[model samples]
Target: MTSTERSDTDRQGLSYYPWWLDNLADDATLEGAAMNGTARGAEAVRTIVAKARELYEFQDFSYADVFGDNGFLEIYDSSIQGEPLKVVVTVTRNAAGQAQDLAVLHRPRNSLLLFSRLMHEKCAGTPLAAHFLSDDSKA
Candidate 1:
């Protein structure tokens, strides 16, 4: 789609999906992209799609709850190597109906470990692995 069409569709909501996935996929990428100022810019969008492809085998996100009219939680039933992962993504939007912030919360134990393992495999040499790996200095 053209940039204008993309922007219009993003204004609709598919735009936020990538940022949500980026939060799940790689923190460094998200931070780096965010450095450019706008979360919905090209760098962030590319990172989101790349991370989604790298990490999740399949994902089905549905509206779990809505707070008032501008905030909501989206629950993702995702699979990695056939294992189930339940992730809750919470988002807050501005008055103009644009997302302002997003938070991703993963289920404990099995799901967290699965995500870490995927991060280790996918992120390897990247700084994003720290988001999953424990701090060695604390030991």
Candidate 2:
């Protein structure tokens, strides 16, 4: 599909299945402002994303568009625990159109910390927990 068409679809809101979900490369990586380090592998990325989404009370995308040949960007406003949160997500795909890298940036340090702490709590006892702040840290 063309860039314009993709943008239009994005504006309409993400579908039940986002394009990148099934198209992630086996070695895809996820990194973000709230994460302590990058999470690698498609399964790990999927798990991390699912957990993160579960924490969001709501999300409203302000901008979602394609950039260059294999780059997609999404900027959205969301809330977690009734606090306002803004997120910028960028995905980079391989030549075959499989997502290779997914990066998320969360704004407002307080919100980020809250989100990170929540993530840490939820991911505890799992390998994903290491990618988030330790429970001992101040949220």
Candidate 3:
């Protein structure tokens, strides 16, 4: 669910913490901890989410009717397990040729960052998953 779904309101102040999460008083971003209670590795999920947001924003998927072209995956999610989700985004050309397709995969519950970048690279056939992930144009 979106972060908003988990927030609450109280007499003293606004509570953004979701009852499902641990250490409610602690911020997840501190010490580089992840929402799933994992250490540095948890950052991986944040990485994915960041990627998804990039895609959504770049494509102008902010409105409710827009329904961003991005998709999500939830691997080993606290709410589920062993889910490998994938999504593809398409960019049609105005050059009279068929529209091009780009895959954007989200590993189960990942934030859709690293893997999506890899998938986009693979779709573009730019040495994805092999090299040049950080620098797509270099390879």
Candidate 4:
């Protein structure tokens, strides 16, 4: 698809946080503790959403339309690291019904180098910077 073109997913108005997610309230929390130098609420939301978009290469998927819940757990076949792989992503919603957490399981575990690199690059020199080079990357 062309970069300027919108996919059917886009036509459906998928976003980092869909309207249904507002049920979580403004103080809703994501899974991880706040990274150093970042605020807890909105900053956490932006950072986590940005990271997911980067990892998924901006593909849009709907939790409501696909799973009829806050989130879904699925395995994706990806070649982002230059070979076939199965990556498991578990998305969960907080009690308030906001999709607030994401966990990814790399099949080989060590296959996350590219993902880490991209995150590090994107987060560099900002309060959003992550210690992804260390074990804290999992946050």
- Report clashes for each candidate as comma-separated counts: 0, 0, 10, 0
By TM-score, rank the candidates, best first: 2, 1, 4, 3
Error of 4 at 7 (Å): 11
Models 1 onward score TM values of 0.52, 0.86, 0.21, 0.50
Top model by TM-score, which number?
2
- TM-score, candidate 1, is 0.52
- Mind giving the per-residue lDDT tens digits that candidate 2 earns over 1-139? 3336546444434442457877889999999999988999999998888888888776667667789888998788888898989999999999988999999999889899899989988899998998888768754
Better of 2 and 3 by lDDT: 2
Q: Candidate 2 vs candidate 3: which has greater TM-score?
A: 2
6-123: candidate 3 lDDT, tens digit per residue: 3333211132221212211122221111111221222332343343333331221111111234312111111112223333322222132222222232334353334334434433
Task: Give Cα-based local distance difference scores for all models.
Answer: 0.50, 0.83, 0.27, 0.47
What are the runs in model 3 whose C-alpha is more than 4 Å off? 1-81, 84-88, 100-126, 130-139
| CA deviation > 4 Å runs, candidate 1 | 1-53, 64-66, 134-139
Error of 1 at 43 (Å): 5.2
